[model samples]
Target: MSPQQKALILLEKQGNFKVGSRSIPTPGTGQLLVKVYSAALNPVDYKIQVDGIFVTHYPAVLGVDIAGIVEELGEGVENFREGDKVLAHGNFYMIDQGAFQQYTLAVATFTAKIPSSQSFDSAATVPLGVDTAVAGLYGKHLGAGITPPWAKIVNDHEPKKPIVILGGSSSVGSYTIQLARLSGFYPIITTASPSNEDLVKDYGATHFFDRHLSASQLMVAINKVTDSPIRIVYDAISLPETQSVGWGLLAQNGILVLTLPALVKEDEGKGRKAVHTIGSPHLPHNNQELFRSSWGMIEKWLLEGIIQPNNREILPNGLEGIIGGLERMRMEQVSGTKLVAHPQETK
Candidate 1:
């Protein structure tokens, strides 16, 4: 019999998450078997339980951000080796690829070496949020069509532009602010509660505003920071009120990137557009080349402190602890921190 491991599985559509046992899956070609140390909770995890949106299979295992040690290498997998510390973009559609288990398979192209500077808990915060931010800002066909910092074609590094990010403390917004700075965007304005102002600034936001500000008030504050037309607004929240503020701030021909489906309709004659992004790298036409380009730089970026993980809040009770964490996220009680669970610690 194959060795078994503990997993949190949703038994049926829109069902409760329960801890159960499953065989540890073998790695396929260009994949690695990861012994998961830290698995991060995301809002979408609970949403999947309530809405039954992404996973199509019953008894689905769900989780997307994983940080762990590689335990075995599949044929032709050269980027990583057995025993290497790594972080990976886990896939929810496949039970073998999910992060909610003690051991799971990682597609090599979506994996990155975890540098010595970060803990497994910290690295667990990166995969989903980092991919979303990079794809939204740098993907040409899917995003704002901005040049990625790692692009080859003598890309401009000093555009000296201004960008506004709504929900600056959100995982996506925080990473966007950091990548914005790396791409040389100046006056990186963001909105969060006053309590997270310093947090966003530390993540490279040059200007911060209270998220509760009225639309006109936010506009007035943004105008004071830079007269430069806000050409790119990454609305991490994308709520109706937040979308309105982002749409109002966007310049002609600007792009408003949204994580959720767009609710605001574009004016008939306006050159502006709202793009709803599908950030999973496993999707068709996901631009694997573009992801590889950025994934290659992750180690150096983390080593040099160019990229930082979300503030981590380690959950108690190992694999069983994830349920409560997801509940907290669904209740909107978790703020400015990524909740991580240790599967190996499960009793």
Candidate 2:
């Protein structure tokens, strides 16, 4: 490996990203310089490429999720060292360390050892999805009351109420269903295309309603399955129509959690809590702890084979692949699939 290497860079104020060479970064305190083997692309990447929401500098790298081997560790980094295989959710808002490059730096708390049994591409897909799902589920106290029967029997306590997952076929939605079920919530209902009903059910969704169904029809389907209304709702697809249907199914004490902002005004009189899950800021003391715990849980699930990586299709042209991939993603509505790229191929 050289002291400097080529990377795919998104130039500031430019509509497109380009392949270029830059000095390889040395890890700063509490960070590891990882030799990236695989990188996963999310819808957010395309949005940032076009809208430039969180980027602070020009010619920045654009990937947020990566999996690879550690080549160097910064001073005070104890949990990892050279040659350790790891998966990281690199900070996108940071100018120097984004993952769409041959080598990227990541903070210790935001990374975890990759399960030996998983491939680099498979490991790459877990961090962002896991973090988003965990944050939405536990960070906001969505299914906190739900405890598994084994846990209840051991602890001698009752289970928590049920929660609903909208858009269960999406990558985040799929994980949300499994996590909710793992927490011991009963009747984990979800809405998705009819074609995905079986797949969602396989992931612990107790019941599936067609997203194409009318709101009244959807509510009726949910009611026939469980008398207990949805106590907590995670709207993975936070569209106006979906929110209307989700809010309609909410039980009196239920809360609604959305990945995107809720466009509709909340009726304080309705007695349901509605909140959006925002990105974590650097200043809050608890943010690091929350981020670490989320990675730990994801690692445990990956090792145990309880949660599997979502389906992925590799983009072959490396850095040159972004334009076509982003275009396809926008036009095709890539539901329930992940796209990945390998930067080394571009060189």
lDDT of 1 by residue, 238-340 (tens): 8899999899888888899999989988766679999987678899787777788888888888889999999989988888999999999988998898899
User: What's the C-alpha lDDT at position 279 in model 1?
Assistant: 71
lDDT of 1: 0.91
User: TM-scores, in order shown?
Assistant: 0.97, 0.90
lDDT of 2 by residue, 1-347 (tens): 74777777787854677788888988889899998888888777887887778676776787778899999999999988799999998766765578788889988778888888898888888777766777676663432233332233433265545778999988788888887777767788888888888888988898888888877897788778878767788888888988887787777767777877777565657677766764332325334556666665667788998888877888897766756777788675676777888877774
Best by TM-score: 1
What is the Cα root-mean-square deviation between model 2 and the actual structure?
2.9
Instruction: List ranges where model 1 is wrong by over 4 Å.
Output: 152-159
Model 1 residue 166 CA deviation (Å) reads 0.4
